[model samples]
Target: MSTATNANELKITRVYDAPVRAVWEAWTDPAQVAQWWGPRGFTITTHSKDLRPGGHWSYTMHGPDGTDYENKTLYYEVEECARLVYDHGGNDDRPPLFRVTVLFSESDGKTTMDMTMTLPSPEAAAETAKFIKKAGGNGTWDRLAEYIDKTQSGRESFFITRSFRAPIDVLFAMWTEPGHFSQWLAPAGFTMEFHDADIRPGGSTFYSMTNGQLTMYGRAEYQEIEKPSRIVYTQQFCDEQGNVSRHPLAPVWPETMRTEVLFTSEGPNETRVTVRWEPCGEVKPEEIEVFKQARGGMTQGWTGSFDKLEAKIAGSQE
Candidate 1:
């Protein structure tokens, strides 16, 4: 944990769209770093990368202006998914231009990264800042985000099944009828405010779900409807008027998702519900990845809501 004496060092912080481990791998993995290590309009070709304490990494950054900057890095410390300390500069005999330290942290399943560049003298810091700002250090981080998403997206679907004490008819009504839906469709701590709801084939529903002071709008267009059996729909974020909107917290989230809920009669007094969720048409690869990354949170939300549904059904039966 060495500190820089110069007062003019450069420090930048960003919260990445991916988890901390993904961010750490992007820095240490040569293949991943080659995809997004340099500024915008620049490409990196790695000659060799030894990612360990006392190891060296050599690469050439090819700028769009046809200038090739030969770079080399000497790793000083490597703490897995936590910290990386290295000396990065041109391949020369003089003192390294700067000592770079990167710290990775995660909160609420997202990654926050901090990068500090320390130069030996204020004069050197001033000179380096111009090149860094012009070369687009910020763009480098932005590219890293795209790389992470591109690498993470896959053909993964979210699936969840729950058993309830109510009959199949009751469970089916809860999903297809707005009256029953308005009673137990939302998760704990959230209430639904319907702007419009028509739960039949080719019909749509729009609503705003509010939790305390926060409210989020959602819309669903029914694709398939089989009474007492299943319901298929395309769901998206929407405004009060039902216009499509981006997710409040995630910008790259898929604009539309295909949701299928199947109801089965387990017995005379029992029902089974299975939900299959996947991204829908024309979605960006990165956006699909974002959906996949959020599977955990989605599962939690569904679990909470299903628990409420189970309780509501029990009360009615009693």
Candidate 2:
């Protein structure tokens, strides 16, 4: 059997809101580098950044529990404002595998970035380097996604649907009221603390969450709010700047996303809610893969949210 053909290959693409120059700064600047680099529970500490060809970018990551991990990479090709190629890996020799390419283009004063990563051949002893990229790539992509949601973005529209047991009024209240929203907006184990929720067209929902050690901001804009029946909005991840962002979990997830929640009363006290999602396909392959998740995922998320809202409202009524 041939060795090359048997190799495991992975391909992912994420478009950034910033130009290649800005991305290069985020990828190189020590302070900006540490701000959003590494995984959710990890933080980065940079030792040096040399962006030109043959130069190196070195840093260490501090995990939630105080574990330190070193990372070092050398840039191979640096075509400013156009492309960058590099070889990166952990401190030790895990074959130091994989090559990354980033390209940037400008149209109508907005920048587009495309990143492609290729791993070492199947023959490499430590062929799992790409899998070890959770430290920075995912989170880094997330920050770029933040920049995209408020600007030009991409991908097709997808839907996430589930039913709610409460009446249309009750379900709608959870979304329109800031206090009501704080109780059920985030995933389990995370608590949302709202700053304010403006519930009309052109209004916004601003909030934050403390997921153990990770403090993150979330935002949504209300477009067409048709009381207790329908609501349209755009949602995104962000930092202190309130710029649109991405999911902290997956990088390829869309940035600027269109969300629609429709409520149809099935009975006196039951409401059927249908949620649809459409990624603003500004990026290439990333937006194309936005709706590829298992159908069961939306069910679980909406179900959990419904359960939480039911309890919150039930307690209020009592």
User: Global lDDT of each model?
Assistant: 0.78, 0.64
Tell me the spans in candidate 1 whose CA falls farther than 4 Å from its real position: 1-154
- Candidate 1, overall lDDT? 0.78
Query: How would you encode candidate 1's per-residue C-alpha lDDT over 47-77 as one tens digit per residue?
Result: 9888889988988899878999888899999
Best-fitting candidate, measured by lDDT? 1
Colliding pairs, model 1: none
The window of 10 residues in a row where model 2 has the poorest summed lDDT is 1-10
C-alpha RMSD for every candidate: 16.6, 15.5
lDDT of 2 by residue, 6-122 (tens): 354333334444555666666566887676576545678888888899888888888878999788888899887788888766455564656776777766555655555566564
Q: Local error of candidate 2 at 243, Å?
A: 2.6
Best by TM-score: 1
Give per-model TM-scores: 0.52, 0.47
